[model samples]
Target: MILVTGATGNIGRSLVGRLAGAGAEVRALTRSAGRATVPAGVGVVEGDLDDPGSLRPALTGVEAIFLLRTGDTDTSQILKTAAEAGIARVVTVSSLLAQTHPDSSVGRTLLRGEQVVRDSGLEWTILRPWEFFSNLLFWAPAIRSDGVVRAPRPGLPSPAIDPRDIASVAASALLEDGHGGKTYPLTGPATLTPQEKIAAISAALGRPLRFEEDPSLATEDPADDLAAAVSFPGVCAVASPGALSTVEDVTGVPATAFRQWAIEHADSFR
Candidate 1:
């Protein structure tokens, strides 16, 4: 059995669906069993990753595990539990910043998690992805009301990836061989600035939306909680050169482009 944590989340939901469709005997961990939406033939177990004891039921009979970094949890305990459970393969969804900026607290936390996975003596694969294109949701309301997108870091270009792309890479690592001990940096085909994304949304929506760039919304600013989720100076993989190629190498396919993602999610602007 393959166990997935954060199964209700954006990437997790996509991954769980795909893995189930591919005929994998999958189990998912959820904070509330009532909230998980796993497909038929899959098992749903209730557990909080922060509490190692809660994970035992989900870990039972599971051959591999997909872990999300739950900050403040005892990672060493989690690894030990997985190892003891005889779960041989572990795939972790790590941040690009973990490798780009190892000194920051957030980066260090991810690095520490990776170490725990490595020390557990189990086969492991880590995926480090750039900014997510789904972040465009932050502009949904602004666009819906006035056809304007208020984007942060309007000048910084990012090869932001789609969450489904991340899921594809995850499923590849879990169901296939040749990925153990490897760290892949996943990203989209084209690099785009925030304004360019706004234009793409406008084109996709068949509307004349405008880009209202906001400079005060730096990821470092305290009021921007959303940016904080993806922020860490000098740590994100978007600035790295070889990230896009790495995704193709591991997945045996090219990652989706930002424009395709925007087109598929265009209804949000309506």
Candidate 2:
């Protein structure tokens, strides 16, 4: 059986379904059983990653796990519990900022997660995905209320990826072999600026939308300026090209283009 933490979350929720669709016995871990609505046949159990002792029941008969950063608490004890519970593998969704902003608090948190999973002696795959296409949903309010999106660095281009693709890769790593000890930096097919993303959403919604450059929207942290997975270093790195990678190389499937993602999730903005 495979255990999925953060089962009610965006990626984890989808991952549970995908794994069940792939015929894996999936056990979803969440703090609230009533809130976790996974595919039929998935075992939804109440558990929190921060509370390592609560995971014993969830880890029973489980061989693999998909861990997510849930709290500010340390995850080493939970990983240790997984190892003791006979887990053989773990696939974690970390961040690209773990490399670009290693000194930052968020970056350190991701690094610690990788370290715990790696030291647990289980076969592990770490997915350090860049900013997700779903992040554009943050503008849904503005798009609905004003038909205008406000963001900082409108000219900045990001090789943002589709979360569905990220979930797919995680599913593959959990069920398949040979992904252990590998870190996949997942990104979209093209480098697009915020303006381009706005334009894609506009096309998907079949309406005109405007992009407003708002420097005040930038975070004071400087590193978290993008307000996504990117960092201050990423602010500069994404400005240039060649950072984009073929998602097929990692997941054996083509990356989802922003336009396609916009089309698929257009209703969210509506």
1-270, model 1: which lDDT tens digit per residue? 999998999888999998999999999888998877779998999988899988998899999998887767787788789888989999988877787667777678778878887887889998888778887787788889988665444345677788888898999999999889988877787777667787888889998988754557555765543344465321122344333666677777888877787799999878
lDDT of 2: 0.80
- Candidate 2, 149-253: lDDT as tens digits: 765555567788887788889999999988999988888888887778888999999999998766776665555533433432223223333345646886677
Index of the highest-lDDT prediction:
2
Kindly report which residue stretches of model 1 are placed more than 4 angstroms away from their true locations once superposed. Answer: 151-153, 216-243
- Top model by TM-score, which number? 2
| Model 2 spans with C-alpha error above 4 angstroms | 103-105, 218-243
Q: Write down the TM-score of every candidate.
A: 0.89, 0.90
lDDT agreement of model 1 with the native: 0.79
Provide the overall lDDT of each model, using Cα atoms, as 2-decimal numbers: 0.79, 0.80
